[model samples]
Target: MPSLTAACATPGMRRLRILPACLHEYRGFSALRPWRRPDAVLGWGRKPTALKARRFAARHAIPYVALEDGFLRSWGLGVDGHQPHSLVVDHRGIYYDATRPSDLERLIHAAPFAAEELARARRCMALIREYRLSKYNHAPARALPAGDRPRVLVVDQTAGDASIEFGLAAAATFEAMLQAALAEHPEADILVKVHPDVVAGKKRGHLLEAARHHPRCRLVGEALAPWSLLDAVDSVHVVTSQLGFEALLAGRRVVCHGMPFYAGWGLTDDRLTCPRRGRPRRLEEVFAAAYLRYCRYANPYTGEPSTLEATIDLIADQKRRHAQLAGDWVGIGFSSWKRRFVGDFLGARARLQHVARPDDAPPTAGIRRLVWSSHHQALEALERQPPAAPLWRMEDGFIRSVGLGVDLVRPLSLIIDASGIHYDPRRASDLERLLNDTTFSPHLLDRARRLRQRIVSAGLNKYNVGTPAAGLDLPEQHRILLVVGQVESDASVRCAAPEIATNAELLRRVRAAHPEAYILYKPHPDVVSGARLGQLDTEARRLYNRLITDISITALLERVDDVHTMSSLAGFEALLRGRRVTAWGTPFYAGWGLTRDHGRHCPRRARRLTLDELVAGCLILYPTYLDPRSRRLINVETAVGLLEQQRRTTRALPLPQRLYRGYRHLFIERH
Candidate 1:
């Protein structure tokens, strides 16, 4: 029997071979190539060929070597008559040109080639099972901890210059925080693991030399798999690190310095303060609210479902490629889309899963009933008011309810209008009951209605209104064109006709503009609540209200154009109803080159547009959604709730300076 080396010396053998003869031969014979070294044989091929060859080598207990270049030359084969070919070998050490018809005839005549190939296939199958068993075995053992000392691991991949400055700053801040925390807790050992790909020189290192100077800090350069490190660490600290949330999944405490989406959840003690005042909720509740009510994950670019893992893989690959081409040191604007995709979508999902999932038990009875108070006025009211009393206040130019007790329940949020004040306390009672039965009470609905009436009457009087009305009265045929705009003094942008501006503005504007059209003008809901405009005196409110009879814009448009605004959200509501909007000043939906911009460039207003293109841009773009109080990403609904509460009360809570100071000093200052 000819050995593989001996058969290689035969004429036309190499030329006719297509797949690497070594790969084919290794697939068949186990005993024949006892001296065939694992590292010496180099395989050259395309990605698919390499994958197949690697998979085969992995199966046969043979080490696979990759050739960076010279695919055809290394294979010792060529195209024959414009057709590709391959070489195969049997366990008996017989070689055959897979492409040549005569080769098969010769092989059958020589030995049991079919039997040999079958044996090789069986071995490959066995190898696959063996590999899977080893890979999926119970997670690897964690690193041994120093006695009586907590172990902290900080994982990041920015030790290389190819990373952007932000990445470097993030890495540095983590290192600093880890060292500082270690100093505070001398018994803790701080372990910094460089990313595996970076250690392999595929990316830059995340740790610098300065990071290692701390006596307690140690840099683990080798690839110590993620699960192993996560298991070993007592707590994980990160500056927007994905591993921080991953640690949370494994039941480790996480301390975040940056405004990672996870930080606002009530699970971890956030070093940074959330901007809006919201009830501290269980992680599961937050997840349910965010996913069920507020957010959806689709492909950032396509608005389609791409699995989370696929998105992460694409982002990781793109980052690597971008770094290589651009030589790193990029700015926020350069990678804003990628950052938004990761932070807004991926990070949010991870936080929702890890932090929001309920632990084994239900929430405590007391916690379920608690409503977070936002301002000092609310706090003061809570302290002074009766246990079950309902109260409202003007805080930070918004109306807010104060106090929490068995009877002090908020039903559906109150929406006051000219017809009368209305709120479905039953709906709120149902929702409260759904969240927790112990906190729900039917009497709370009665208390809420009475409280709403009091607040409305007070608000109307404060705004110098003679009566408390429930709903706006407008003609059925009138196309209610709610012109939402920023009022400069509350009086400068009033209607020209008192009836039209008051209750008949829509009718008057529509009739004027279309001569046959009817329009209605409704005062902004914010103004009616006596929020930001509550400071205005009676003369101001009356003068402002009367001025509705003189403003020329409605007369000029010659349409029953009702001026309506509820602190700008009305613009969105009006747009939803397909009403034409005219701006007195720039609102968020104004500059999208979408609506009729009476203030700026109005190019070809004849073209009709889709609602998505207009609304998505305003809600998803324009406003940064920063919590003005905390300067963090404002949870949209929470912000809206707080703003509403503030408009009702004169007393407001001061910003949480301590939280802001800590966040800036630890994360933003270093970054």
Candidate 2:
């Protein structure tokens, strides 16, 4: 946990030894003693400084280690915050382009694969195959060639890339490979798949103009994932590209025109030679050496060290979330600035179209309309003249426990889906459907349970609004009941809370039910910020033992025996934290055999559900999430982690700004 310090060395001198700092910022290790320096030093690649560091370490009689990324990266561009899932740290030399018998070559040749190691390799490979996972999780848009004319995929790498520069390929090698493929597979359908960097305009490739016009050859410019591209092709042609190795993994015939890392291993058809790797290797043996032994993985969300299996599952989940978010363009009715939060979650691929009125509708092909159920005009118009686009009812998510002291608080998350909104009783929602229809898989249930544990342990709330617990001195014998208040005008209360119409009525009911219990009343954040109505007067407030405001929902949940609510998300958040929840209305979390439901229960929801099933449906499956700061789509786990970080560090607005935002909210509500 020690910060890198100049004091570790003499003034203006370089760091004598590299500290064992985590490649990711979220992880940490205690500082090593000055006298007990590392036996070796590690570098990602053979950069100039790395060589110099090696020299320096050698002079000090310390071994030097070089490093590089392993396979299976991420869906995002690595230009920003994304880090690699795997890295190779070698004491013999750099792995990718070692001059003479690198550590990887030694390991692949001499290392023995234990039975358990082989089993792990098999498991990893199976998961990759089942998920269709690749370095990048994107799938190709190109359709598979029908009738099987023997398709050959010629993989193109960025010109002057490390693999080409270090291995047997050059700048003109890609063009030469393309021509060779065309000549050899004259009757075959030849498709040239470009590297991701080329498609993203980060780098250029060799054969675009000529390859596009060839009669039998087609140039694919899209940045589709290589694994998906490999599925449609019968054979792969590469010059020292990783796709050649991946081709062997996919069980496709591979033709390596140059001496790539995987060539000469008897697994590939090599046109070139690597005499050092003369020994034959099974695919699993090669896999075990390259992946299981040589690489280390870290959790994408928490940045803690992780297993390859867990990492694969997370990547699959993230990729699925990304695709769902980008499904279609979204048109929102009666929009506000906060609607940007919803739009952000949908991501850049899904364009946001503002519809001020019904007449302002745009093209409806593959379009989705987001309607707030409270807006009667927009809702009625949609019902009367239904658009071709699907309906995505939008609302706040369960962990929406935070708001700025002012009304300008940005949400940590929002829910937008094709099914009915969670609060509305007019139609069935995605959550209701999943609860009714899903036969829980043990693996998914286990994942959900682990996720729930992390959320609870981290003390993460919906908005991650930072509020400390109140230091309360309670009568030891009194039973504590937390009464959650909500906006009476809110859709959830109006449509679901038939018995308790107002905050006062909710309080009255809780008090009447437990006359001897100590009652703690908490007004909704919206009401407290003056963005909406429903705050109690002094006399009404006096009915409760204490009116809590300055405490966080997490803190309240810990102290209370149970929570009483008229269909507020606070009840759901409390449930996640292991608090007893008594639902006065049929909120989405109720009727699932989890909460104590006093309202209507659907007959379809007769199946007993676990905490993970509820979490999987509500948090992971039901809602789409975006990192508000980055305005990009993210997975549920990442959303929770980011919210927790934001909660701890976020600062409130100044008095003037707070007053202005409060006024704005009040104006909007009054209108």
Candidate 3:
């Protein structure tokens, strides 16, 4: 097959989906028509490949719809094999083809946007600006020329683009736009933004030939974020470029030299006019018609239908996580198992080097240091002799996995602490600072509440192991006190619980504290499987009234009224379940006034916190979740949904099939 660029003759078109655009999206429309056409012809907007489709449609008397990329498409470019999240379906004509009325143009002329519609449009616009989002969000921040002069931005587009050819624009039109910008503002510096296609070296642009030599002009060719470019400019000039509409949405002065779809709507200063346009409309009204009514959106991850606002938030979140992890780092003492998955959280832009110890690591400029938090010996060694780079500690998050980590099951979430790790309460961790100092906004609190409800109702826990306690004799009405166990050799237990370090000691203390309460002792799953230390002593069984085994911790939590622990994650789960939690040691979740703190009055945690506030700092904000399928960092809500779906789907399958799938996805990590 011919290369996409070779056949299409446009830079970056090689990565394009290549099938006819708008018409493919209209298959249902064609089917719903009274004529009962089950199939219809589709073509990419004005591409040469669509010529055959047009001929086939004409010959067979089938309706043809032209497909174009929507205004807000994907995070990356269509030419880079990133498919469109949104598509423009035009039956009358494509939007960029100004020779005829397009469906978008018809919507702009006919749609009556009331107050409610306009309000939504306004909010969407505000969020776009607030997030600094553009159609393609993969670009990095730009380093424009430093100056205080007013900037006049001139946009450039790829040569031979259908939008220019059909919008009554040519090489001379770009020249005129550049000249007008320079001539209009005598003291203003002219910023010539080279099109992304041109930057990718797929094609040439028109403005470069005219604006290259001018002392007042500077060519911007880097793959920089377009919103940042718009922020830097006072006014914008364009000929059939979508940046003109974005500039208008951003409240910048836009001058259009050609009759693009947005030009005739009376939102811009236009050099060319289309006589078919209707009454003057506000920016929000135009936006409501174009984005809310004339386009169709799909979730980029699932290809399911989605609203524009939701897609915007999704893109913004992805961009935010990418920005946070975009740097070089040195990894210290990550085991052979963990080495497979660390890169997923570090992001594609980061460069990571693994070193056995802090002393052997080389110091480099602008690089960070990362180490596993549970490696107590290494962490203490690092504290004794610090490395040159800043250190970051990471551990498995609260909602970890379906199976035990000792069984080689990879975690879906991780906690990254720049201060100390969350388990070590001797010093304040980042999670502590967030709880103490940061103000919790209503929106964040609401999100945290929803997340907590989901976790509680679903009976989610640290490891999500076992089924509810069953086939064991226990009292129904009596007050219950559950004692959670931990690995005796674990660093957290050694560091946090100096007074109480074993399961037997925890059980004995719980029985002493609650003399009448029914004491139930549960051992850690790792201990049950003989993977680590901290097995319950056979002689110590007499300390508690009941010994529980072969049951899910989450299910057991519901049977108990109060949970006592020396720093187990199960105590946190019990708190979420509305059971009273008594902390025997200083866990991260304890000392916040939410749990009964018998361990230590650190004096640092003097403030009382609501359940939702505690959850907000611990679950939603502190930890980052990874999508197992895509190997991308996601939020806690998405993580919950993934685990829920995975568990349900695995159970529904046959035993043999489940085993086969498990083998296929054994490692489930990225290098």
Candidate 4:
């Protein structure tokens, strides 16, 4: 065998490209069509796509290569071009098609493993097993069947698929293997795991009705994740499925009835053999060649070439997020437009029961949790007779800033917890508790610091609205102070700033105090978009040097030396940018010795806080941010990435959408 690097560097290697370059995505009715020309052809498979590409390549002398998805695939649907995180592109031939000597077999036999390569392979293998990750990292469809007896899982494959035709060489092979498993291990609990495609109605399988009812047999029809099945069973019986490879990865006994690439290797109990694969190999050697050396991976988040460790971390994070999305639905009492936003942001994970009024009981069928606003009428009704389900308080995030110029708005960030909300003055909020506590982990602080740097550098704010703040002029001799305004009727101002009732009164006070300073007043997005109150009259507009409405909050923060706000998150954003902040109201971010507070301060928050600590509590710990695209709960780091992408890619709303928004705005204002 040649050096893998040398093989890749070969001029001919450039032409030795893999085909059906990617799996085609399933878009339902629109996607149901015959396979068109692919970038190259995938070979030796009985599937229509594979057979067509194979013939076309041969007929036209087009270079074609065959490949298999490597160990860690993805957390979503694997086939149909959803994109695999890892794959084994074979130039010689498809690795599973036992008729030919493939590059994988040659590499397994002859590729020299340095100590570093072996160590890395071991680490990669450990992560795969630990996470129970696979080509698609999904939770099992059903629990493992209840039986104390030793279990033997007979993995089924799609009939007429590539693996069945090329490796098994017989159509009836799956049935033969199932019968053999039951005959050999008669006392064992024989669980025949059905193919996912078969369960999805996308493909056919070989499971007979008669075999399913056999006393020892329990046809495992659930779309259980492959890894979950592999982990539960003592041994795996297969006629060439990726599950056999995964079973080997998990150190389970693998009995291959047909020649999979992993089968001919001495580690597995093989009923079929590849004569060319004569050299016996260890798991790490095979893994190192197939995964670390052979496969190509693109990070699902960034679409850049990724390391196995990074991909594993990402998959694990997504899995947790998916689990979060699947949690019990919360019956939110009383209706607000924001409730719809909450449901959309939370995605399909938690169910939202939008009760039209306090008298409306939540749907009894699936209601186990309750969430409501602090001042909502439903809160009073629930207090009269508390339900069995736990209650959580929901509120907006500090950086909830983007939908300013238009009537449209979304809570890109929100908080939901058992503790009181951030703006509430009556009870201690979760954020206040975090801020006052001194025992936060060093790792949490470090993460906050990194997040702060990322947030600042990316120029991301709640709204990410507005154009360049570039040309706005500041007089050379005076200090520039930004006066941030908020919705006069918003709950935060009503609760936190009792003294400063209106934007005009707040502006008058700020202007009188900083008479010499260049005051720049920016109205809240809702005000600018005419969705809510706080629009200034012509006489009131002249109180500031300039009334800024078009520039981005981040840009304005960068230009100003100081920011004064009632309880606007702009003060917090300015704090992250190292600007001096003066608070006219006792916002959650105040009284930690971080700002000059005028209204109120929590006696509990006596500790002088770092920006990261503040960030950890406010942004990381407290809020639930949803990815605008995926609509799943994402970490602040991921949120920053998404928001930055949003900032870079955000365009003016479509005319139709804008018109619809106007109608929605009128309805909202009236209500």
Best by TM-score: 3
Report how far residue 485 has shifted in candidate 1, in Å.
7.4
lDDT of 1: 0.34
Candidate with top lDDT is 3
Decide which is better by TM-score, 1 or 2: 2
Q: Write the per-residue lDDT of candidate 1 for residues 1-671, one digit (tens) a residue.
A: 32332212112323332323334333322212334534323333222334544555555655444322110011011221211211122221111111112221232233323444445434422332222111111222246544466778765555422112222234556556666557655787787777555656777754645445767777766644355676677887765554554565456788765534344455564555444212354433422332222221222222223322222222332222222222111111112222222122111112211111112112332211111122233334344544342222111111212311111112112211111111111112211122222232222233233333433333311112122222334466645454333232332123211122232333233334544433333443334322323233343233222222222222212333444432243444444444556543333344344455434332322233345444322222211222233222322223333434444562422345334444544564345
TM-score of 4: 0.70
Q: What is candidate 2's lDDT per residue for 1-671, written digit by digit as tens?
A: 43322111111112211122223321222222345454444444665545555655667776655656667766565555455555665667555563456777887896468889888898788777766777666553345547458789998776766667667667777778888899988888888887656666778887665567888887777767677678788899998777887788788999987666677778888776776787898888888877777666664444456667776776776677666656665454655765556667665546676767765776565777777656777878876775577777676666553454235566655677677777865578777887778776665677788888888888776655536676765667999989999888877888788777788877787888888999998888767667777878665676689888767777888888989998988888898888899998878788878899887766656778888888988877776666565565556776666666666666765677677766767686678
Instruction: Evaluate model 2: give its lDDT.
Output: 0.70
Worst 10 residues of 3 by lDDT: 1-10
Compose the digit string of candidate 3's lDDT tens values, residues 200-317: 6778888765666899998887778888888789899999988899899788999999988888777899898888884687888788888888877765443346677766756676
